[model samples]
Target: MAGLTAAAPVGQPQMLTVVLEGLRSHKGQILVCVTRSADHFPDCTKDPDKRHFAVPVKNGPIPLGTVAPGDYAIAIVHDENGNGKLDTFMGIPREGVGFSRNPVLRFGAPSFGSASFSVAGAPVEQAIRLKYFL
Candidate 1:
């Protein structure tokens, strides 16, 4: 038998790939935030342990890197203004917003449970569709 490494190296976290969709235009930057705490679900600002990434806006897959095995929720913002933050008007998001599981966006951001997913020994993928409101 051709024997090789059976699994990932010790201390190596599981990989996560985020497939992005529904970007209004190719401008500004994309912000990806991952959190394990429900309290910091969509906002993620209060969670010091949250994983955040900023990439140029484009139509493609976003590699969010490795994470420990656990339940997690992701929030992504299409910052059209490149302000490094999601803009809003009267609590309404002026830029594009998205969640891990592509949950329905009502009057406000969805709860953590609505977009939660699990990462185990294997790789994980989450597809999110950005939503926009003027």
Candidate 2:
């Protein structure tokens, strides 16, 4: 006996869902950036092709969905003033910021290689804790 089989399409794009933790307050939006290049790791504004998303900062984690499959590094900035940019005081960020792998903070943001993770064909989740400098 032969029967029809329902199989998922081959080579479907994967998704990377990021959940941000330790938000200071629910005042503004959360700026999220995902980059596949080391040259444009933390700053998505510098690269016009990089993927960026923004959502309100609630008490819990914020989820981002439907991301393409690939090796990528993520950056998040809690824009407390909804200024569409990370406010800085003397070259240091005043808002809460985070990275995908929660790399050690030495001088500056982590390199793409240090934070990068691969998304094959399944949904991946990353939980990042926000860090505030001020």
Which stretches of model 1 miss by more than 4 angstroms? 1-12
lDDT of predicted model 2: 0.81
TM-score of 1: 0.88
85-132, model 2: which lDDT tens digit per residue? 999999788999999988886678888988888776566788888899
Clashing pairs for model 2 are: none
Q: Output the worst ten-in-a-row residue range by lDDT, candidate 1.
A: 3-12
- Name the weakest run of 10 consecutive residues (lDDT summed) in model 2: 4-13
Can you write out model 1's per-residue Cα lDDT over 3-121, one digit (the tens) per residue? 75466654568989888887779899999899999988887878999998789887767788889988999999999989999999999989999998888888888899989998876
Alpha-carbon shift of residue 127 in model 1 (angstroms): 1.1
**Best lDDT among the predictions, by candidate number:** 1
lDDT of each: 0.87, 0.81
- Write down the TM-score for model 2: 0.85
